[model samples]
Target: MNQESNNDQASAMNTEQVSDQSLSRRLKLALGLSLFAVMAVILLWLSSIKNIQNLEHDLAIKLDTFNEKNMQSLALAKNADTRSAEIAARAEILEEKYTESFDQQAALKALYQELANNREERMLSDVEQLLVIANQQLQLAGNIKPALLALQAADTRLQGFDSQKAVQLRKSINQDIQRLQNLPLADLTSISLKLGNLSQRVDQLALVSDRHPNSAQNKIAPDTSNNPWRKLTQEIWQDIKGMIRIERIDRPELPLLTQEQTFFLRENIKLHLLTARIALLRHDEVTYKSDLAAAQSAISLHFDGRESLTQNTLLEIKALTSNHISTELPDIEQSLRLLNLYKLSFVPALAREPKSKRLP
Candidate 1:
């Protein structure tokens, strides 16, 4: 019985120990699982905190970027607004210029049309009038230069027309011009001015005298001695000589002029010079020659002929009188006649045309 109890106790103790070891192992496993859960929870909380911080930082950066982009967009928008206003102003200026240009173009067109309307007839009339004026100048004024100019103007007008019909007229006008060009023209103005100068010098001419006498000086009476009787004798002889004396003059005698006659002579000379100037200006060949001759004769007779100035003036006057004042100039009658015929033919044909076919 004792042995059986001991064995039974041993078995019981082994079973109890096995059961405690199993329970301890289960407690150890549960503690290890709790430690792992606590560590996982701490790790997951740290990761979550870090993720929150990253999200906040990212949000701040995005906000800053958005603000910067928004500010730049605002500035660009403002610049766009300013540029748009400037463009509007420029467009308005351009529009005004366009309007002014259009108006000027319209005025130019009207002016061109008006000019075209009367261009042909007016040109022909101008040419005809020029030819007439040239003829008149040649005939009336004897102005070769102006007549040539008028003829040249007519020729240029004909050439501007570039018509075959104007060829004969141009040829006639050219011939007239050449003829006028070949003629020598006297400088009447210079001659007239010279005459006027001579007239002014008439007052300075010295009067001529037929004879000049040598001046006699009285000799001092021979020293009259203090002798009263001798002085009385000399005085008595002088009184006898003074009462009746006959002196012989060596020079030819000339009649003395009264002051009034001298004045009248000078006035007559001036009058002649003035009359000669007038005749010269009038281009009166007959009166010019006669008056100049009379003036020369008067100057030679009254003025001192030996004076160098007088001799030179007389020579110049003689030279001027030798020139022919009147000259025959070739006329532009041929050109005038040709222009009239052209006008008669051209104007009649233009008049016969229908109104619709006319320029205007």
Candidate 2:
């Protein structure tokens, strides 16, 4: 019986030891599970921390990008505003230039209209003035060439007006010009000049003397002896000879004149020549002819005709006296009358119009 109890105690000890080993194993498993859970929680917490850090970094980058984009947009907006301002300034300048150009065009149009409105009256006034000048040239100066030129200018000016009223006036002017051209014109100026020259040469005429054939001859007394006693003896001899002189002179007998009479004769001749010149200028044919004849007679009677100058003067006087003077000159008044009539007719029409429509 004691041997059996000891064997049973050994079996009980083995069962308790097995049960403590199981309990230790269970504690070890619980510890291992607790470590695993702690490890998992730490890992999750680390992952969350890393994720938060990444999110924070991404948010910072987005903020930086947003700030940069905002800066770029602001720069773009500023540039756009500057460009808009420049465009507005340029538009203002263009508008000012357009307005100035429009004003200039308006002024030019007004000036053109004013010139067009007064063109006819101004042309008419020019025609009238030219006609007046032409009339004066014809009547006063007797200048056919200048008068014709003025008339042609007037006609040309009338042509610019293209008026039918000017036809009769132009025709009258042309007729007057033709008549003037057909009229005989005396060269009175040339004749008067020749007469004046002849008058000047009257003083140079050589006086004629009957005592000498070609020149003046003065009778000289015979020479006496040079010695005083011989001169006395010669005088006594001449007294004894009865102071007789036997000279055979073949000179023609001429009326003797004193110095006063000779001076009067030359002055009378010059006076006649001057009178002839006056008559020539007066266009008096009868008076000029008579005066020149009287001068010729006086020169032939008192002066030597053999001189070349005297002969030339006589020939020129004869040539001048031969030209006949015509009392009739063509009437240049026809054109003037026509111009006056045209003015009279046109003046009433011009006067009936308003003062602003009249010629300036």
Candidate 3:
């Protein structure tokens, strides 16, 4: 409605411009009005263009400022990334190098502690307990070279042990060790030698048990012999030594009983008979007595130690020989008692035995 009203007013104004008496006067007035309208249009269009240009200039300045600030932010981020990478690389290098040196020094400190006398002495009280632990561990799967090296290392470290144990260990254990390399079951070889000796010892000692008898009421007469217990103890000692040598090659099949052991066991009993005759001829019950006692202890040690030796057959012998000897046989009781100590060692042995599951 407003646009129509405006159009009507413009038409009326155009009519008035043309209204005149002379054609020349009217033409001049119409031309003046058209020129004025054109001028007004040109001025309005010019003002609009100027406003647009000013707006574009202000926007351009804002864009330039934004681009500059963005560039600075990007450069700072890159610098931070580079510094972080450098710090991380340095930290890794220090961890690899210095940490290794620190650990090496700590290891040296532990070694020094191992050699200290106070520390060494402290370990001895538990040494007997550790013997089985060591034996069990030694029994487990291990490389031969490493096992031998570890054993040698132990010997080297304990080289300065107390004189008493050192003497016995040297005189007995080391002697047995001399034959170790030749044996397949490295742990049992020393005990094998002891067993060999013990077979004869047992047979000979049996004679004493036969003569004196543990059931004897009193010393009725000399009987031209040592006490029965002494003889029995001696015999048991010798038998155990031989038994330790009794190992099976097939290992896991039944209880072990090697060829060497069978041969030693059979022949040794005969040798004991001869030894008894010799004792009778020499009138040297003391020699027999001493040897029998010593043999008992030595054999006991093997059974109780690394050989994982056992006394099953010996217990059978005791049952078999129970009626053969009387109750007065102190020597037999003593030997049996010592053997009993080692007998307990069988528990672990049988548990670990390739075949047997009886106690030690």
Q: Write the residue-wise lDDT of candidate 3 on 191-304 in tens digits.
A: 324335446445333221112222243223333466898767666765565555334366343234465764564454545434533442333445434433443443333222
What lDDT is reached at residue 33 by model 2? 90
Could you say which candidate leads in lDDT? Answer: 1
lDDT of each: 0.77, 0.72, 0.46
Of the pair 1 and 3, which is ahead by TM-score? 1
**Of the pair 2 and 3, which is ahead by TM-score?**
2
Q: Which residues of candidate 1, in runs, are more than 4 Å off?
A: 1-117, 120-129, 156-159, 210-283, 345-360
The residue-by-residue lDDT of candidate 1 on 16-134, one tens digit each, is 99999999999999999999999999999999999999999999999999999999999999999999999999999999999999999999999897786468668778998888888
TM-score of candidate 1 relative to the true fold = 0.49
Better candidate by lDDT, 1 or 3: 1
Show pairs that collide, candidate 2: none
Determine the backbone clash count of candidate 3: 31
| Candidate 2 lDDT over residue span 235-332, tens digit each | 67756555453444785645677778888887887787788776655556788788888888877767767778778878887787788754444554
Superposed on all Cα atoms, model 1 deviates from the true structure by an RMSD in Å of 10.3
Ranked by lDDT, top first: 1, 2, 3
> Candidate 2, which segments miss by more than 4 Å at Cα?
1-162, 214-254, 344-360
> What is the alpha-carbon lDDT for the whole of candidate 3?
0.46
